[model samples]
Target: MDDLPDDALGDVLRRLPPRWLAASRCVCKAWRRTIDERRLLRPDLLPLSFAGIFIQFDSHAFPEFFARPSPSSANTKLDFLP
Candidate 1:
C-alpha cells in the first residue's frame, strides 16, 4: 500500500465516506497529508444533508443511518439521548 503514488492513494481514499476519511487522519502522516491536501472532507461537498439520523448505541448489528428528506422537507435538528 505504501508503494502507491499519492494520486492513487488519494483516489482510493476519496471513495471513503467523509466521516471515515476524517478518522483516517489518525492512521498515518502520509495519508493525513493526502486527505488534507486534497481537501476531501469539505462538508459542502456532501451529496445530501441528512434530515433524519438514527443510531443504536447498544446494537452493533444495525448500521447507523442518515436519511434524506422528502423533496418538500428540509433538514431538521436531532436531539440524541443522554
Candidate 2:
C-alpha cells in the first residue's frame, strides 16, 4: 500500500468502511499519517452536517428534524426561531 502514490492510496483508503478505516489508522504511523494527510472523506461516506441540535421544552411534544449533509462551505448552526 505504501508503494502506491498518495492519490492512489487516498482512493483506496476512501473506499474502506468506517470501522476498517479506524482500524487502519491504528496500524502504523505511516498509515495514520497517510490517512490524515489525504483526508479522503468522500461525500457519500460522511455524516449529516451539524446544522443545529434541537430539543423540545414541552413535556408532551417530541421534536423531530431530518439532518442532511451540507456542502463543506456551509457548516453553520443557527437557532430555529419558532
Candidate 3:
C-alpha cells in the first residue's frame, strides 16, 4: 500500500462510504485529524445555486398538489402556500 501514491489513496478514500472513511482516519494522527475535519466541514460547504420550480394552477389542478410528496426533514421544512 505504501508503494501507491498519496493521490491514489486519496482517490480511493473519496469513493468509500462515510463510516469507513471515518474509521480509516484513526490509523494515524494526521489521517485521523484530516478525516475528522472533513466530516465537520461538509455541512459548511453549500452550493451556490438553490433553485426549484413551482407549478402553479387554479381550481382545476389544486387537488393534485395535496397528493404530491411533502419535502420536510430534520434541517429543511417546506409548506405549500396555496
User: Which of the numbered candidates is closest to the native, going by highest lDDT?
Assistant: 1
Alpha-carbon RMSD, candidate 3: 11.4
Instruction: lDDT winner between 1 and 2, please give it.
Output: 1
What TM-score fits each model? 0.51, 0.43, 0.37
Q: Cα-based RMSD of the predictions, in order?
A: 13.1, 8.9, 11.4
Kindly indicate the candidate among 2 and 3 with the higher TM-score: 2
**Model 2 TM-score, 2 decimals:** 0.43
lDDT by residue (tens digit), candidate 1, 1-82: 8899999999999999887888887899999999989988896754674578887767657867868646766556575636
- lDDT string for model 3 (1-82, tens) is 6575555666667777765776677688656555555553253442344444455576666433234445675445356555
Ranking 1 against 3 by lDDT, winner: 1
Task: Provide the lowest-lDDT 10-residue window in model 2.
Answer: 40-49
Lowest lDDT sum, 10 consecutive residues, model 3, at 40-49
lDDT of 2 by residue, 1-82 (tens): 5677867776788899876886787788877788888775444654565766767778799976656666799747676656
